[model samples]
Target chain A: MRNLFFFIYRFRAFLIFLSLEVLCVFMLVRYNTYQGAAIFNSATTYVGYVLEFQSSVKDYFRLASINNTLATENAALRAELMKYKDIEQTDSLNKMTDSLYVVTDSAKALPYILHAARVINNSIRRTNNYLTLSVGSEAGVRPEMGVITPGGIVGRVKTVGKRYSTVTSILHSQMLVSAKIKRDNTSGTIRWTGGDYRTALLDFVPLHIKPAIGDTVVTSGYSTVFPEGVMIGTISSVEREPDKSFYTIEVKLAVDFAQLSYVYVVEDPHREEREKLERDAGIKSDEP
Target chain B: MNRKFGFINIVQFVLFVSFQILFMDSLILYSTAFCFIYVGFLLFLPLGISRVWILLLGFITGFTVDVFYDTMGIHAAASVLLTYLRPHILNLLTPRDGYDTSDTATIYAMGWRWFLAYAVILILMHHAAVFFLEVISFRDVWYTLLKIVTSTIYTCLVMVIIQLLFFSGKRANR
Candidate 1:
């Protein structure tokens, strides 16, 4: 017994090192996977507060660009509103004489609800990138909700805190977005292989379909997270490798991840119902 | 081994960690070279500190940085490896008269040549571990290699500059 104690004492440093390394690796593997809630992420209260403070300080420098994007988005929204106003006037005139029409819940008619949030912290250089948002459960942001900017899709919320949330950015290696070509409707998956933040690879695009450069890729809406027809990016390059069945297409992402400040979190109201129904039907659902 | 954790060391720890997660986290050069200045704090710890304490401190520091970086344990794993190898590297590069109890692993204390070799090897190992563990695959070997090499050089350059600017050669106890 004394001999064993001596042995342990002699190599205590190595033993400690091994155990700590094992613990770290355990945490790495455990938290690395897409799970319900993460404790050590930036969305934690203190870390979120610090990051929010830092972003608040840095935000001053980006006010000009933020204002520019906001103005452009406002103009686009105003034009869209004008078109909708004319449609509403004609529709209401027709419906005014029709007293037999049954009233329906407008909220139920809308499949998705958007919540605006400010990005407090973001990183693009890591293998798995994540963004911290200023809104969380308090603002109806929850896990698995898709995040998007006016330019394009950003990512999906991974975890949520009281007043903060963390998003798994589209730039993450493990993150895959179901996308389709806007022109021919050829469907594939968009994944970011490390190296460049502005680009990602669209896999499973069969070689039979001739995808040209500048072809727009948008969400397929096959998943419950992102709504269909949201812009992802344009195909910059398509390579037909020898013996490969699919063309390796590169997409230039629309949103500039580096300058991201404001984003909208999309919440699918009917996601649980659809998912439960699919689960009951024994159909496997794809991750967001 | 007998030295205690000073108030200055605690302050330095907080400063190093905060600076890393806040300022240095965003400062990436050319998209490939990342400046992990927090490694400097781990690298320049007092030589007299025990290996066990060093290892624990490394884990704590890396874990703290990991939280803000949202990488969970990658930083901690790399840092523990770095601290584990620190003593061995010091033994390998021992000076003629050996190290003083008050000596720090700084450029001023150890000279530019020794400091460079020490910093490069340790930083290279840490970066390799971090980048490889991050990707968890050998798929993008060339790009990962480029990142490790560039980040090592970038981190080493920054550490050296920080050492020169902040850490002076004069030891008050001596």
Candidate 2:
């Protein structure tokens, strides 16, 4: 007993370190559990309230840009209505009208594919850029959901709360988004090169695949995180080496990440079902 | 004599937290206000404060900030680390026997250079721990070192500027 006590006393700091390490490990292991995630949900709402008040003052400067966006959207809606009218005679008029009516009626169009949120807190200088959004889990946000603005794809949802969510911007090195060339079906993964926020590197495209500058890239829909057809960026440059098997393409993001503020969180209705299937498949494969 | 500063500390916490959540959050050009509060609280604790109190303060400050940022317990863990390190930092700089209870570690008590060194070291340590914790928080080690260095430098610079401005008022009065 004396020897044991002496041993513990000799390394008191080590024991403390061990205990703390254990606690941290426990917390980390239990992190994804519902209780741990719910805490962030509540905190985000509180933080959102504080940021909402602060942005209300600075929001004036954005009035002009927001007005321009609204005007453009309004004109596009009008054009869409005209196009529908021209095709109304040829197609099933009532079915087309039902689809068009939802968007044409301004009241129902308030919350569409993209939801607006004020940026409460944002960090860009860090290699892993994270932006705090005013919207949260209570607002229908979930982890792995894609966040975007009028400009382009911003990032993916890292965590969500009742009234706020943290978005990992495309500028982050960890952001791996699948994108495809607009002109051709060739697709590759997009990741930031850590050199410029305005540009990203597209990897895994074969050298045989032809790609051109100024070609648009959109989400490939492989991951349920983002819906198909969301704009990613345009190809700014392409590099091919004789020995290398893959062509590396440089993409200039469509969204001006530096000026990002308001954004939307996209929810994939099939995510839960998809995840369940993947998990079950893995378990069955391991059973043999 | 009553240790009347409890309410004052709470008020400071509220004000600093409010500043972080509101004004500093949206401003990507500068560091967030929570960084200031983290350093500010460290400066406010009286000389010879107990270790437990320091740990408690660190945990609360960090947990609250994490709650806002949606980072879970990362800030809390980092804050606790800062709190544990502050006394050691003070010990390293102003040896306990040499410190005067009435004089805080502000610029007035310690020269600008010493204050700068003190605040810079603490802020760097805090930011480094936070960046690493965040990286490990999700189990993704990719670009961990890069994130640590960049965020630490940015957070440290912002912290230094904020300390200079906020503590200068006290020095000016002195």
* Winning model by TM-score: 1
What DockQ results for candidate 2?
Answer: 0.21
Candidate 1 segments whose C-alpha is farther than 4 A from its true place: A90-93, A99-108, B1-4, B172-174
User: Backbone collision count in every prediction?
Assistant: 0, 3
| lDDT for predicted candidate 1 compared with the true structure | 0.89
* Model 1, position A19: C-alpha lDDT score: 99
Predicted structure with the largest DockQ when compared to the true one: 1
| Top candidate by lDDT | 1
Error of 1 at B6 (Å): 1.5
Provide the clash count, candidate 2.
Answer: 3
Each candidate structure's TM-score, on Cα atoms with residue i matched to residue i, is 0.95, 0.75
Q: Share of real interface contacts recovered by each model?
A: 0.80, 0.10
Candidate 2, superposed: residue stretches over 4 Å from native: A1-37, A41-43, A89-122, A131-143, A158-160, A163-168, A193-195, A241-244, A268-288, B1-5, B25-37, B95-97, B134-174
Residue B170 accuracy (lDDT) in model 1 = 74
Candidate 2: Cα lDDT at A167 = 73
Candidate 1: residue A261 lDDT (0-100): 92
Clashes of 1: 0
User: Model 1, A187-255: lDDT tens per residue?
Assistant: 999999887899999999998899999999999988888988999999999999999999999999999
